[model samples]
Target: MVTVNIGTLHNVLDHVYGAFMHRTKISPLFFSGGWGGSKLELLERMIKQLFPEVVGQNCPPTLVKPVWNTVWETKTACLREGVFRTPCDEQLLSALPPECHNARVAFLTPKFVPPQRMACVVHLAGTGDHTFERRLRLGGPLLKENIATMVLESPFYGQRRPMMQFGSKLLCVSDLLLLGRATIEEARGLLHWLDSEEGFGKTGVCGLSMGGVHAAMVGSLHPTPVATLPFLSPHSAVVAFCEGILQHATAWEALREDLAAQKAAMTLEEVRERMRNVLSLTDVTRFPIPKNPDAVIFVAATDDGYIPKHSVMELQKAWPGSEVRWVTGGHVSSFLLHNGEFRRAIVDGLNRLEWKESPS
Candidate 1:
C-alpha cells in the first residue's frame, strides 16, 4: 500500500472536484493552526497544488487595501472565497500593512465550483507567536532577509494608548471571565460572517494543538458547523494536562507542579468542586457533546506526549458515534505523515451527501 500519501493521485482531486460540483451550496475549506506554529504552510502548499490557479492568481500588494490588511483580507478571502488575486493594485497595496501583504484569499467562480456539495472547513492556528503581525510577515521566501525587521517592538509607556490596545481589553475580558465562551462567540461571529458574505450555509472546523481545542469547543457548541475535525485537542483535557504530562515540559511545568502540590493538600472532591467551574473545557463526557452534523477526530498518538490516547478516547466517548482517525506519530507529526489523507478525509467528508454517514 502507498502509506506515504493518504489522498494521492488525480483520483483524489477528481473526487474533490466532483463533490463541489454536485452541491448548490458552497462549502469552502478552513484550516486552523494550534499555538501559532501549526504547519500552515504545508496546508497552503497542498491547497495551491490542488488549485493550480491559486498561485497563478497571487496578487502583489496593490489591489487589496493596506498591504498588511491586504494579507489578512486575502487570507480570509482565500479561506472563505476560494480565489486569490494577482496583478494587485499599487496604491491600494501600499496602503496595506506589511503583515497583510502575503496572506491569501480565494473565490468560487462558475468555472472553479466543483460537482459534489462541499462544507466549509476552517483551520484555526493556536496561541503561540503572540504577535499576529509577526505571523503575517513570516511566510514566503522573500521574508528570509527581513524577518527580524518586521517585528513590532514594544516600548511600554506606563499609560495606555487607546488605538494600540484596540483588542487588548476585549481579549483580557474574554480570557478573564468568558472561560472559553468568548472563543465560542467569536467562532459563531466568524461562521455567520462567512455565511452572509460568502453564501455558504454550513461550515466545518479543524484545528491543531491550541487551535484544535478551540475548534472542538466551538464545534460542540455551534450547529452551523455540521462537521468538525479537532485534529489534536480536547478543551477540558487541561485537568489531565496539569496533573500528568505537564511535569516534564518547560512552559507549563511550574504551573503543573503547583497544581499537583495544591491537589495533595486538598481532597479530590474539593478540588473538583473548586476547579469544575474553570476547567470545563475537557469534560465533554459530562456536558452534552453536540454531534457535528458529522463529527470526525484525527489524533497523532505515537509519540504525542501532550495529547494522550486516553484523553482522545475519553473525548471520543463523550462524542459517542463520532469517527476517530488515529495516526502513528506525536501531536502535529502525524499531520506531516498523513497530511494528504487528512486533507482527503476533510474534503470527502465535506462533500458527502448524507450527514448520517459522517466519520463514524
Candidate 2:
C-alpha cells in the first residue's frame, strides 16, 4: 500500500500553473503600467492621514445609499446592481483615476427572511475577479440559509478598471494602494448601510485572495461585531508581492527605476525592500482586532502557492480566538474546488456572532 500526500500533489499543480502563467508570456506582468507618478506620493501621505480616521475613528464615517437597478430576478432571489460615488475622502478621491471614481456593487437577496433571522454577507473581489457572478454564485445558495450576498467591485477591476491598466496587471504601486484604500472606505460604507439601513439580523464580510485581505481589514475596522472570513489570503500584501508567486509577475525593473527617481539612485535589492515597505501597510494583523474575534474564521489552503500557511497562521495568532480551518488543496485548486467549504465557513462564522438588534 502507498500513502500519497495529496497536498503536495496539488501544490505542484499550483506551482506549475503559476510558473506557466508568470514565467512565460501568458500573463502580463504586474505594475507594467509603470509608476503612478504623483499618485504614489499622494497615497503615501494620505495613508498616514486617513488610516486613523477611517479605521480608528471615534465615530463611523457617514454612509451613502446606492441607486440600484434590478438587473436580474428569480423565484428565490432578486439581484440588484448598484452605483454609488466612491466614499474615499477628497484627497484620496483626487488620487483615484477617473474611471474608478464611482463604486459598483451587485447584491442578491432572498425574497424573504424573518426580520430577526435575516443575514447578509458582503463579498469583496479577489485579483482578476471582474464580475459579481462568481461571488454571487458562492453566496447565492446561502440564501436558503437566509444569508444575502453583496458583491463589491474592487477598484481597478471590472467596470472600475482604469483606462491604461491591462487586465489584472496593475499599472503602478500607488494604484495598488489607492485601490485598497478606496475599497476599505467603500466596503465600510456598504457594511454600515447593511447594518444601519437594511438592518440584517447578522452581517459578515468574506473574501478570497486579495479580497480576503481587504475583508480582514474591513472586519477589523468595522465599529460593531461582524463575522470576518478570509479564505486563502496572506496576512499581508508583502507576502503576496514580495515572497510568493506574484513576485515573478512584478515589474522589478520598473520598480527599481521608479524608486531610483524618487530618491537617490537605488539598486534592485533596495527597490525590492522599498516595495516590501510600501506593501506592509496592508497587513491586517497590524490592524485592530475585531470586536468579536471569536466570530472570525480563516479558510486556508494546505498547500497554497500564493498564500503560505505561515501567513494565514500569523493572522490567526494576531486575532486571538479566530478559528483557522485547513482544507486540502492548493490556491487555485481550493478556490475552484472548495467553495462548499468556503460557504460552510461563512455560515459558521456568522453563526458565532450575536444577531444585531432590530430597530423599533
Candidate 3:
C-alpha cells in the first residue's frame, strides 16, 4: 500500500484554490440593470438612511413568532426558531427584486430564564440548502451555555428561498445583493426588537462564513451595544466570490458564461469592478466601527482558502482593539479542528462582557 504525503496533499489543494480564483469570471448583469452608478449610489444612500446611528434606534421592531421544533429538543433548553416578516421601506422594496421584497427572517432561540443576556448569532450556511446540522453545530454550544442563541436565516435561504428556485442557488448577482440588503435590514430590526423587550440583557451577533460577513456588517451598522464575532468570513464580497472557494462552484461558472455571452460589450474587469461596488455596501470597512471594539472577536483560519488572509486582516485593521483567534486548517476542516476552542472563546468572551457590565 502506498502512503500519501499529507503536506503534499495540502499543497495540491492550495494550488487548486489559486487556480479557481484566477479562472473565475464575473457577469455584466451584476453591473447593469438597477445596479449602475445611480442605482448603486441610491442603494448605499438607503443603507445609510436605515442605519443612521450606530444603534438602530430608527428601525421599527418586528413581531417574532416562535415555532417549536420538537425534533431538536434538548435538556438544557427548549428548541424553537422564531420567524418574522422582515419589514422594509417601500422605496427600498421597490429597488430590490420582487422575490426579496417579502423575505422573512428566521432565528433559533433557546428557551431559558428569559436569557439574562442573548447572543444572537446569525449562523449563515454555505452555498446549499439550509441544514439543521450546521445550525446545531454552530449554535449548540451557546444554547447549552444559556446564552440565548439566535441564528438568522440569511435572505434567499431556508423559508425565504424563492419557490421557483428549488435550491439555494442565486441565479443572478442582483439576487445576492438583495439578499445582503434584506439580511442587513432584518438584523437591524431584530436588534431593535431585542432592545425593546423588557429585561433582555446584552445581545451579541456572530456568524460563520457568509453569515460572518453579514454579522460584521450588522455589527458595524447597528448602533446597539452588541458583541460582534465574525468567523471564517472575508472583509469584502469581492474577495469572497472572486478569490474564495465559491469560485469553483458550478453555479458561479454558469452565471458567468451566461452574463459573458449576453453582455459581450463589457469586459470582465468592468463587471468585476461594478460587482465590487455593489458588494461594498456590505463591506465591513465601509461602515462605522463597533461601539465597543474590544467586544468584536474575529475567528480566522490560517489555511482557509475560502477567505483569504488579507481580507480577514483588513477587517482586523479596520476595527482597532478587536481580538482574533487563528485556527489551523482550511475552510471546512478548520471548523471541525477548532470548533471546541472556538466555542470556548465565544462563551468566555460573552461571559466576560456580562461580568464587566455587572454593577460593581
Candidate 4:
C-alpha cells in the first residue's frame, strides 16, 4: 500500500507552490473536473508517483510542521465577502523537511467542494481492505491514461457547495449570470501569478464538462498554456440540468432559488449579464492563440446527450482551425468509459513540460 501522510502532503504542497512560483514565472497549474470520477484525487496520486522525490527542497525551519495559520476559511476571509486569503509559503515553511521545502506547487481550485476530505477518505478506505483493487482501478492503471488534470468535483449526483458559493459571489453583482466573477477573478489571479517570474512556465489547461469551459476561458485569457485539452464539456451546454436530459436540476435553477432567498442588490438578469461579460472567454479566444499557431486539442463525446457535441463543434469552428477529438459516449460516460486511456494522455501532456530533470 502506498502510505501517504496528510501532514506531509500539506507542508510539501506549500513549499512546492513556492518553488513553482520561483521557477515557472507563471501561476500554479489550474485543474477542473467533469462530473463523476475522482479526477482531482487521481491526478495528485499520479503526480506523486511519477515524481516521488520532486517534493519541495531546501526547507526552512518554520516549514517543518503543518499549521492552518492562513486566513483562507476564517470568519475574516469568508467566501461571501470575497476574502479568499491563503497561507503564504513563508508562513508555513518552517514545518517541513529541511531538504524539501522549496518545491513546485500545483495550485488546484477544485470546481465542486474541496475534495480534500473525501479524497482522503477514499484513499484511506482503499488502503485497508481493497488495496489491490484500488491500485488497479483508480491508482495504477487508471492514472497511466488521461493527460490533463481537472479541478471541480462532479456536481451531477448533487450540487457542490463550492461551485454554489462561487456562483453566489458572482450573482450578487449581476443576474442571469453564466460564470461568476469570483471564479473569473480567482482564475485571473492565478494567471497573473503565472506571468510572474516564478509561476508555472508555459502552462496549459484541460477540463471536462464545466471544467472544459474553465479550461477554455483560462486558455483564452492566458498565453502561457501552449496546449489545451477540454473534453466533452462546454459553458452553455446545459441540456442535462435544463431539459432534464439527465433528469437532473440545473445549477442555474438552483442559483435562481438561492438568489430569491437572499434578495441581494443585483437582479438575476443583471447578474447573468455580468457573468457573461466576464466569462466570455470565447470572445477573446483569438488573443491567446499560440504564436507558433499550433491548434489546441478539444475532445468531445459525439453522443454526449448532456453537453451536446454540437457545442464542442462550435468551439472548434469558432477557434478557426484547432484540433478536435470526438469520442463515442455520453457526457459522464465519455470519461468513465475510457478511464484508463484518458489518464494516459493527461500524463503524457504534463510530461512534455521541461522540468529541471532530477536524479532518478
Candidate 5:
C-alpha cells in the first residue's frame, strides 16, 4: 500500500480550487488593467518613508472621530458600525478613486470591561473580504476571553469597490499597493483611538493573507507595543504574484503591453521581473521589527499552495523572538479549519505584552 501525505493532498486541493476560482476562462481576472501609470510612482515615494528610523514620526493623524451610525447590544457584547474619511495626504487622496476615499469599520466589545482589563484587536481584510461578517465571526468566540474585535472594509472591496472593477480582481498592480498603504494608515488610527480615546488596556492588530501583510506593517510602525499577529501571510507580495499560485491569476500580457506603450516594451519574462521589482516594496523584512518583538506571533500552514513555508519562516527569522505555530493543512483548508489556532495565537501574542500602567 502506498502512503499518502495529507498536507500534500490539501495543497493540491488548494491549487485546484484556486485555478477554478481565478484561472477559469469566463472570469475577468485580477490586475487586468496592468501597472498603473503616474499613480504608482506617487505611492512608491510615500511608502519609501517606512524605514525603521523615521516611520513613527512620519505618520500623523489620518482620521477624525468616526461617526457610529449603528449600535446594538448582543447578549454578551456591544456592536457599533461607523464610517470615516481616509486621512491619507493630498497626493494619495488625489490618486485614490473617489469611491475608496471613505472607510468603514465594525467594532464589537464585551459588556463587562474594567478600565485596565480590556484588550482590543483590529482585524484587517484579506483578499475578497468585502464585509466584516467573517472576521466578526472569528472574533465572536474571543469575546468570552475579554477581547474586542474591529474589522475595517479595505479599499476596492465591499461597498468601496470601484464600479468598473470585478469582484476581488483589483484593476491594476499599483492598486494593490494603494490598498495596503491606505489600510495601514486607517488601522493605525483606529488602534490609537481605541487606546487614547477609548482607554483600552491593550491593543493588537491581526489579519489573514493580504491583510496579514498590512497588519504586520501597521504593528511595526506603531509607537507603543502591540500584539502583531499575521496569519497565513508571506514575507512579501513577491511570493504571491511571482512565485505562488497567484502568478496564474495575474494579467501578464496586459502588463507587457502597458510597459511597451509607456516607456519600453518588455518580454513576458522581463514583465515578470518588473512585477518582482514592484512587489519587493512590500517585503515586511525591510521594515523594522515591532517595538515589542516578543509580542509577534505567526500562524502558518504545513502545506500551503498560495504561501510557501519559506515565506513564513523568512519573516520569523527576520524578526527574532517571534513565534511560529504550524497547523496541519494546506492554505485553503487551514483557513477554513484553523480558526481555533488563529484565536490562540491572538491571545498568546496579546498575553506576551505588559499592559500600559494606567498612564501613571
Candidate 6:
C-alpha cells in the first residue's frame, strides 16, 4: 500500500481539474477579428513604440469626481461611488460602449475617524455584476480595522455594464483588453488621490479574480510605496482565457462556429500564440515588482480550475520574496474553504505596513 500526502493529493486533483474541467475551446476570430488581426497588431506595435520599456514610466494622471447624489452612510463607514473618464482618445473608446467611457467607482472611509494617519486599501471587485452585498462582505474586515477601502468598478461591470447585457457576456476579446486598461488607469488615479489626501497614511491595493489581476497591474505601475494582495487571480491573461475554466463563459463556442462557417483552420494553441502580445500587456511578470516585495501577498487556490496553480507560481516567481498562501479546493470553493484565513492574511498585511504621513 502507498500513502500519498494531502499536498500530493491536492496537486493531483488540481491537475485533474485543469485537464478535465477547463479545456480550451478555440475561436478563430480570436486570431482573425478586429481584436486579433491588424487592430491587435497595431495596438501591440503602439505599446512597443510608446513604451519601449514599461518599467519606470508613469501612468497617465486622471481626475475623479464623486457622485454627490449617490452618497450613502453605512453603520461603520460612509460609502460614495464616483466616475472617472478615461484619457484614451475616441479611437480606443470606440472599442468600449459609452457607459464604460465614464467608469463608475466608490470608496469607504471609517465613520468616526478623522482619516488622518490611517491606512487605505483599494479593493477591486471580481468579474460580473457588482453587488452591494458582495462588496460589503469582502471589505467588512478592512473597514472594521479603520482602513479606508476603495472599490473601482471594472469596465463592462456594475454601473458601467451596458444596458440589457447579461452578466457573463463579453462582446469580443478587445473588450477585455480595453477593460483591463481602463481598470488599471482608474485604480492608478484612485491611488494617487489617496496619496494626495492630507489624512491618508499607508495605501495598499487588493482584488479577487479579475480584480486581483487589475490590482497586480496597478501595484506594478505605481511608483508609490504600497502593498498588493491578489486573491485567486491568474498571472497570465493569455493562459487564463486560452486554458482556464472561464474560457467557456467568454463565448468561445459561438466564435468557433463562426470560424467553422468561414472554413478557417486554427487550433487552440495557435489562437493562444496570436493573442500573446496583446495579452502580455496585462501579464503580471511584465510589470515591475512592488516597492516592497514583503508587502505583496498572493492568496491562491490549490485546485482552482479557473486559475491554474502554474499561473500563480509564475506571478510568485516574478515577484521574488513575495508571499503566497495556498488554500485547498477549486477556485470558487476555495474562497469559502479559506475565508477566515484569507481575511486574516489581508488584515495582517495591512497591519504590517508602517504607516507614515504624506509629505508636504
Best by lDDT: 5
Error of 3 at 354 (Å): 3.9
Whole-model Cα lDDT of every candidate shown, in order: 0.39, 0.87, 0.62, 0.35, 0.89, 0.68
- Model 4, range 11-122, lDDT digits (tens) per residue? 3443454344323534211111111123223322322321214323312112111121221333212111112222224322232123222211122121233221111000
- lDDT at 12, model 5: 97
Residue-wise C-alpha lDDT for candidate 6, range 203-247, written one tens digit per residue:
888888888898887787776767888998988687677676555
lDDT for 283 in candidate 1 is 49
Off by over 4 Å in 1: 1-69, 72-118, 127-179, 247-277, 291-293, 353-360
Model 2 ranges with Cα > 4 A deviation: 1-4, 49-59, 114-116, 358-360
Sort every candidate by TM-score, greatest first. 5, 2, 6, 3, 1, 4
Deviation of model 2 at 29, angstroms: 1.2
- lDDT by residue for model 1 over 1-360, one digit each (tens)? 646543233224433443443222332111101111112222223223212233245221122221222222232122112112222235323422233223232221122322122235555544332333322322222112111111111111011112232221211111212223323334444444444544443455655565566567656655444456666565454533343332122123222333465355544444344334434434445444654434555454444545566777777766776667766565435534555545555554454324322322
Instruction: List the candidates' TM-scores in order.
Output: 0.49, 0.94, 0.77, 0.43, 0.97, 0.81
Q: Scored by Cα lDDT, where does model 5 land? A: 0.89
Any runs in candidate 6 off by more than 4 Å, and if so which?
1-39, 45-52, 74-76, 87-91, 163-165, 250-269, 358-360
Q: Rank order by lDDT, top first?
A: 5, 2, 6, 3, 1, 4
> Per-residue alpha-carbon lDDT of model 2 for 133-244, expressed as tens digits?
8999999889998889999999999988987777878888888898888898899899889878877888889999999999998898888899999999999999998998
Task: Give the clashing pairs for model 5.
Answer: 260-265
What is the C-alpha lDDT profile of model 5 across 123-209, one tens digit per residue? Answer: 999898899999999999999888999999999999999999999899998899999988998999998888888878899999999
Estimate the overall C-alpha local distance difference test score of candidate 2.
Answer: 0.87
Q: Provide the clash count, candidate 2.
A: 0
Pitting candidate 1 against candidate 4, the one with the higher lDDT is 1
